[model samples]
Target: MTRRRRTACILAALGAGVAITQTACGGGTPSAAPSTSYDATVRADSPALYLSLGAGGPKKQKQSAVALKATYHHAPGVTSMPNGDRASLFDGTSQYVEIPDDDRLSVTTTGELTVEAWIRPDALTFAKTDGAGYVNWLGKVSSEEARTEWLARMYSRDNSEARANRISGYVFNEGGGLGAGSYFEDRVRPGEWIHYALVINTREKSDAYPTGYVKVYKNGVLRDQDALDGYDIVPSNTDAPMRIGTAAAKSYFKGAIGKVAVYDSEVPESRLAAHCRAMHGTPREAAGT
Candidate 1:
């Protein structure tokens, strides 16, 4: 089937809120749980952090069903999704969510990690001192000193060689200057709700590289990937806490952010796709895969 047709089918299934099952990459078939029930089912499979920006206002949003139950320091403003669900809106200048640093949220040199989010940006570019630039969707960095440990953000169209509105994933080791970081890239459009995921498999070594293999997915499909090899994307004990809608004071995202999840283990390709389907209001069985 064509990409357009496949996307249409997935959206249709999501709209119906149908629950379906599909086989995970490793083994047995796993059920595609609805977004509402995701915390219970998916979280049970592995330790994770789940944040649902639902009908309530930003101040009312809370971490759901996770062991740590991290709290969020949200800025003002609210927006509605296509489904009429409320989401937190960030205005490049100050709107963002700050989650305190936690050991569980940190990435290591030899473990799997996954970060996923649902976002819809008002504009791809935001104002900066030099020129217009993109913003970060989610990040974890140190505030003491300007250091980015790990983050998923849109590349600065005015400052980088990357294509306009491209999404990039970054990782840096502790005490390793920003130059010691590695990144992967993909593209995204503004004003549309999209599911973005970053999967890092540290257990598997790449033939051509030394670090972990990384994959970036959009709408449940892999779009870009690379190996961390020389760059250190993992964080040490001193790294900063994870934040949503911004990375420290800069790169504040200008958009409405919905569900954000962080998994300690790499999410299987099938399950990741199912989660994306659920976010769009469709059931996996209806995807016709």
Candidate 2:
């Protein structure tokens, strides 16, 4: 080949290298998740952390919107997402991601917090991740004894066939480990994509929901509410790293996880529901998978 032609080809290859992975440059998939209508809404509110984990299966996606990167484990599979996007696939055994601890995660005082994720749990039966047989998916609890902050997880069939694959949102106190949790099972369809959310407001105290309260959502709709009896939050435990697809390194989630965001403030019900709607532009369907 001519010298000029060879030089041009090398430059062309280097230009495509901007993607997080080599596959993004050659594979048919695009390098990022498409923008959604709610992107503006989330951007306006400015969440403390937001991760678009499906940037063509990159080990890390630049957190341009919120400035947070994720470290993947065991090379989870990248699968085609329902909304014309891509997501990280967990083997239901040992794949997850971990983000370093940051001060912004420590939302204290009237511990207002909102955690959201778009997940498609596969049809396979997940094994026990914790003693309770629940696979913790996301949150701030570093370990079983590390400033137990909060985590979002799914129930394994080992706990109860009836409650298997259900979604639960739990929060705990920092030093001690007292906790409160709420769950929703109607949304557990082994093979479909659903937007899930957990909202907590600790402004007021209630005997039933003593430490505060938590609400679980499916496809942006409220499914259940429960108390977070962790004797008031111990702050957002800085020592505890922000984790996804697993909690306390005990429970690991299987299936696809994408489009994760964390806000240190309580989000309104209406807006929370809108987030799910904005993600998928299709007609509304029933909850069951």
Candidate 3:
């Protein structure tokens, strides 16, 4: 069977009354996903890279997008997803997926980009008090060997930046550190599937934000946005691996990562909302679609 012929995600909704519902492949019991698969939304977007955890690996994608097999550290397990599909589960302590970086994976400094995912975090807040009191769930991040580009990070219960359990989208100036950013104010509880997106547009600038702009979204709804002021978000072109469940394999994520997609251009808000609606079992005709 194909890699995508795995277990279905647990979420099943009847209507508005059942706002959130779930099912699981507990005990690692695998189920064959439908032939249509649950990743149609990511595929339809034609991203530079699309990781369908339920579909097995990169080769399973029609584009066969891989120059190397992903390296899984600490062996994150495959488990139930909230979207009626399976996902890669992380342990937060030492579990993550590392992809060899490439130019195709990096966007230009003055370009537009969108990185999105479906995730169910085990904890939105962390115990860490250092490194800005946050952890990177994914990004081309800073490390001793690599300069930073962009990141999708979560704040601790009391971080100096957000001061709450919040999600932040950031773009760095290639020097490999925290740069200009935006964040979502909502508290993300554990075990629930959430659609998270980071959209960056550097071609446009303003007086307050002379560099560009960044947007953060949750469950397809616009949460926050900000201007990039001091620095340009130029990709450092480092050999750092594009990672999930952690940025540089240090700030690990404890949860399940259902799907990941990267677009070279900023994805329109309507499209992101439609994708979110579909995963939520919402009708496609819900205003935007």
Q: What clash count goes with each model?
A: 6, 0, 6
Clash-forming residue pairs, model 1: 13-282, 14-281, 14-282, 15-281, 171-233, 211-229
Q: Write the per-residue lDDT of candidate 1 for residues 1-289, one digit (tens) a residue.
A: 8966765554443334322212132233223334454434445555467776553334544454444433445544666554344567777676667667666676663377788787776665666311235565687876543655667767555555545777767666665355222333444456677667877666777575466667777666677677676565554544477777776666677767877788877887777776654444423233332
Against the true structure, what is each candidate's TM-score? Answer: 0.74, 0.75, 0.77
| Global fold similarity of model 1 (TM-score) | 0.74
RMSD (Cα, Å) of candidate 3? 8.8
Full-model lDDT, candidate 1:
0.60
Q: lDDT per residue, candidate 2, 1-84, as tens digits?
A: 896675454334322322111121111222122344345545566677887676433376557644667788767777654434
Instruction: List lDDT for all candidates, in order.
Output: 0.60, 0.65, 0.65
Instruction: Return the candidate ranking by lDDT, descending.
Output: 3, 2, 1
Which runs in model 2 stand beyond 4 Å of their true positions?
Answer: 1-38, 56-58, 160-162, 175-178, 204-211, 230-236, 282-289
| Model 3: per-residue Cα lDDT over 127-188, one tens digit each | 43238787788988645525777878877776776557677888776676547788876656
| Residue 199 lDDT (model 2) | 81
Candidate 1: 10-residue stretch with minimal lDDT: 18-27
Superior candidate under lDDT, 1 versus 2: 2
